[model samples]
Target chain A: MSEAFSGPVAGHVPVLRLGDVLMVTLQGDLHDSTAQQLQQDLAETITHSGATGVIIDISGVEIVDSFLGRVLAEIAAQASLLAARTVVVGMRPAVAITLVELGLTLPGLRTALSTEVAMDLLTQGAPRVGVRRESP
Target chain B: MPEHTAEETHGSPTHEVRDFLRRRREQIAQRWADEPLFRSVFTVSRDEAVEAGKAVVDALAEVADAGRVDDPDAAGFSGVREQLARMGVARGRAGLTAAQVSSELATLRQPVENLLLSDIGEAPAEHVRACATTLTVLMGTLRVVVMQTALSEGEALIDRQRLQLLEVATPVIKLWDGIVAVPLIGTLDSARSQVVMETLLQSIVEQQARFAILDITGVPTVDTLVAQHLMKTVAAARLMGAECIVSGIRPAIAQTIVHLGLDLGTVITRAGLADALKYALHQLGADIVGPTANGTGHR
Candidate 1:
């Protein structure tokens, strides 16, 4: 259970494979080089595990610059190329406001509130279809 | 006349300078009245000008008699300054400029100097110089008092304008029953940010809004500081039990965010106000079913 937490102090990104989903939780401040390395690691993990979905939890990261934003988008783009959907979860309200303010929409990147929501979204067949009413 | 007590000798100038001006007070008043600038600038009747002139000459005589010339800070100047300040306020109310007030003070110097130098002929040279210096110092102090009062009035005006700008900057509008939106425009400095947060939270509690949409479509640029302010607004709304959705994420801003590599974790964002409203409605379990979709209205 906690084995996933134990890894090299630096240059370490925890990637857990749960069924067909690859869960990656980003913690601490990620340097430009560290973010680039994680992009590579996520792509490699997706290929080897044959995961159909990627959930990135970024609740711990307090700051996101343009480099980090690009890396996250790149990871999503890479996952999609491998036939996997990327759902970034646990983004703090501040981080979202900042990212949009910086002018990066992370096109094609799907977002969910929490890991459970992301998992549920992935399990569902289409974009969360439920009781929807029409405004007359 | 009351007895000339010892206190008069100590309390008033009672010096040669005081007697010189008092004996010729009418003459100095006449000279001041004859000055064209005083008559034209004051815009008062001939009698009013002479009355004002007499009062000023009398005030100077009072100070000179007090023997307070050696120390301008002496209590004697308080009475002098108060009289001048009264005159200054009246002049200000009459729409007089600072230049006119100062020139009026300067004009008094000539009449007094002429009286002291000529009327008190054969007086010691040093005594004459002392009287002249005392008059100059007193008049200079009066000029300062008048300007200070005017400056304070100007500052009060500026303070009012700044508050008005703050009120105009943050406007939280109610869009629907449970939805309120703050359309922020212009720079988001710390002062404006504080206003934005306070107004949004108050609106949240007052309207009991379940959803708050902060639209920054008019914000020229999104920097780290601006981002921090938005985060604070959202957190405050959440504390009030309202969900905040940021909208107006233009393409350029989107590119900048990704390029900056800022991670906006799970806070929901929409590209425009309409989308954010739609999402808010959906969350509220209400949907806008367009009339055109069913083709019922067209028929």
Candidate 2:
């Protein structure tokens, strides 16, 4: 899928279609501007494609500062509102360190090792709920 | 030999007086050369001694040729003796006193003294003082340069450390199928919060998932700053239209959150991974409709 916004600062944003799933790979630094562009692009892609699930591949990024992380979280929240599932893929070691050091945690976020694994999980059958407990 | 009047007094007595005068002049010259103070001040080596001797002899010859010594009592050696004494006093004040220099020469003997006179000569006080000052200045300059170099190296090291942190922070993979699972390990500060936020938001848009599971079992504790950042993330997620489910709340973290009075009112929180997974399944409309024993179900 093409980027929602294009400019000198925009890096490569690749869109791939696997069966009914649509995967977008984000490469390089995802600052505020970049995140906005990605959000715009994803919104457009989702509107037209009718893909069941979407995956974001971020293996190439070395740093994910607070602003960029917020953008990603917002994207997931927005996409869920539109009835599409979102998955994040491929976090490097440095990014992991910064996240922990900064004490910043995502409340309800899913992660996969690779884009293929994420796609498999997304297309899998419904999740099994074993039991239900009444609220105390 | 018979003295008549003063005008006739000459002859044999004159010859004896002349010899006495010559002896007195020689004695004065020898005394000046032997004086320790004078020798130390001048630091005269063999060449200087030879030259001084030749000059004295030449002056004496000129005086004799001029016939200035008509009588022994009138001989002019007193003036030369006074000049030598003055030279000794001046040299002594400059730390070139005759006694000290003579002792040094005695230890080194004639050969070394001759080398010093021919090559180095006597060092003046002004020259010595100037050399010392120059050395001090150079040493100070060198010290400053060394300190500056060390400071620059330290700055570079800090920069490298920050870069290394960034290298480990970027997230590359996410799965947002039925549930969103974010496994967080390590302390969370403001800078890292941004990274986590970006990764999760992007993952949500890409995966189109309904429920997000944030597992923080790896975290040891939660500080105020970190807690605030988490709250911000939850808020941002809501704005994006995704539901955030926090899992893996350690007991200590729960206590801290309560103690700090952090309001996590809107976000759903679970105590462990199993509970979070159950909630995730339910939120995705995968609730078990018909249950067989042992958690088996058809949605």
The most accurate candidate by DockQ is 1
Residue A3's lDDT within candidate 1 is: 45
* Cand. 2 TM to true fold: 0.37
Instruction: Give residue B137's lDDT in candidate 1 (0 to 100).
Output: 65
- Looking at candidate 1, what is the lDDT of residue B286? 72
- Chain B TM-score for each model? 0.68, 0.46
Candidate 1 Cα outliers beyond 4 Å, as residue runs: A1-136, B1-123, B292-299
Candidate 2 per-residue lDDT, tens place, A16-134, comes to 77766778877775656667877887877877887767888877787788777777778788777777778777765456546645654555556655565566667873432222223
The TM-scores of all predictions, comma-separated, are 0.52, 0.37
Per-residue lDDT value at B238 in model 2: 48
Among all windows of ten consecutive residues in candidate 1 chain B, which has the lowest summed lDDT? B5-14
Name the top lDDT candidate. 1
Candidate 2 structure quality by residue, lDDT tens digits, B1-299: 32243224322222322332243444433443454533554475644443443334333333343344332222333334333334433544466644553343233223312332332233343333332333233223222332333344546668999767754754534442535677777888767777777777677656754456677787778877876777666655543445677889988889999998988787789999778877776754455367668875664
The DockQ values of the predictions, listed in order, are 0.04, 0.04
